[model samples]
Target: MSATYGVPNLEHCIIIAVIHNDGTMHSIGVINLEEFDNAAAVEIFAGRSLDSEEFAIRVVAVADADHAAQGVFALDAITGAAERAGISLLNVIMTPKIAAGQHWTDLRTQEYGILPDPAMTAPAIAAIVDGFGPLPDAEEITRLFTEITPADTDHARTTQRDNPRFGRDTLHEVRKTIVEYLRTYDPDWADGGVIGADFAADERTRLLDNTAEGLAARIGVLVEVSGSARDALLGLAVIDIPTAARIYTHIANQLEGIHRAHMLAVAAVLYHVDGRPFHARDALYRCGLAVLGESGHLSETMPVIGRALLAAARANVETDTARRFLALGPIAARRFGIETPDYDLYPAE
Candidate 1:
């Protein structure tokens, strides 16, 4: 994926992606060089802060508008970014151009002009597959979390309105309900499917904030990492990860903006807390789509995907599956202050 680079204010595009040895690729996505510089650009090329140690990298800048000049690409900022980030800026490339071409030059091999089309490249394929292909479309993804065919979310909304949950007495009841439920909740949730309908609606009710204050009760119940949600999610993921993903996603769909974002984070916690990386990726990817499809709100989906990036990066056992989600990390951290950098997937931590 060639990105637009800025050499004295040229509006161009370029992309940086990594293809791991396992044939999976991740891209921080197309970056506008105009908006980046030596220091700020590190978040694009690497991460905001080192997680454990410096990450190794080999960046190949897709020369914007290849000139006949043998090797002239605007690479100073890129070179400087690598230095600042303490990474190996392995090579710079100046491809003759793409489409009906097959030769290119890199700093190492210095090969010239290669590839049929950007669409045929490894990163492009992975982007299509992982970002927007095969997975449920945005609308469907939203529905997965919000659908009331089996249970009614509007009823949940209605209950909160009619009950005046903000009352001192009712808030106490809400708090009591959550505390008691968490204390005794069967994490396995394998109660023969008979209780799922009634159980699901009750859970959805707590998550809806149709009124501004309604969201408080739900956040109160689940925001604490030490809350039983950690143990419950861990046990549920082991027993039926799909069901847990389904439940949390449904709970999130009724929310808007930051509210929806937090519930989506729960999916990351439940799956990755126990090393279910593939499940984590799928659930988060769909959750990302759900956020995008949301109406009437300018939502910040960065945290939703950021938590996914953290889960993938921290995965110890499912390296291959985790690689599928690596490219989304920087978008979460590097994007401007729409969401916080804070994320904790260990519900009990």
Candidate 2:
């Protein structure tokens, strides 16, 4: 369904939201109610059914005193069809201009300063819906909104970089917190569910710092990746061994910004200590993919990573001189359990 609606007139904007008892607001869509008659109302809600027990429709008008009456009339006209459809029409709410503007501004971007424009109505509606509940403090509401908004790759990158690494005391606190959260963790989490690049990198750093002896201890293992995390790492294998090694070393040393970068670091350390470079790289790669999935960047990052996986396989399979031998290419891809990218340049032979 279309997420936005409006008219060009200068009077006011009517925001119609069908709010569920569980606090989820299903929007009947917004409109300039002055132009919203019975016909247009039916057009907006036509065939749109709602659970009356769970959902109620509310019309809110963002208008000053000069236009408040008109706004209410607009809501009354538009909601006639909604009332007929058995959708309980709640009170028509009028928001002062200042409050409306504040809510609008908050929804324009995500917490990491990423802009999700042209479809910002949902965030705005969320803010209004949140106000109806037992309102949280400003700080919590800000955090809540940030958590709810879907993040892009840029947001993921920015979050990875901007969040400061906690010191030793803070690390212990974080570990304790994570442990508490995991106690109730669902064992049935989908593969690639637990581990994340950012999360693992931090755990690795803490392990290395505390364990003067070595990373052989269980403390160094960190979280496990469940899905096609291994498949994503094949891209790194395509790079020269030296370059890959350098990348891994740098990530380990500096605790790079993204989760994939952290996995690279883990792979490097594992290669030096464990003599299992492929295994290390695969584990980290999978963990990084989990991070991408968590950050909602998987779909966008998949093609690049997936292509690299397939390319690495094709290169090794065709050319005997290749350094890396990916023995289980097809099986690995299938096990990774995501749609492999269409390789136009290097079609499968």
Which candidate has the highest lDDT of all? 1
Looking at candidate 2, what is the lDDT of residue 336? 32
**Model 1 worst lDDT run, 10 consecutive residues:** 1-10
User: TM-score per candidate, in order?
Assistant: 0.31, 0.28
Residue 260, model 1, lDDT = 55
- Count of clashing residue pairs in every prediction: 18, 3
lDDT of 2 by residue, 234-316 (tens): 22222233333333333233222243433443343323222333433343455455447556674444333333433444553
Q: Which stretches of model 2 miss by more than 4 angstroms?
A: 1-11, 98-349
| C-alpha-based local distance difference test score of model 1 | 0.43
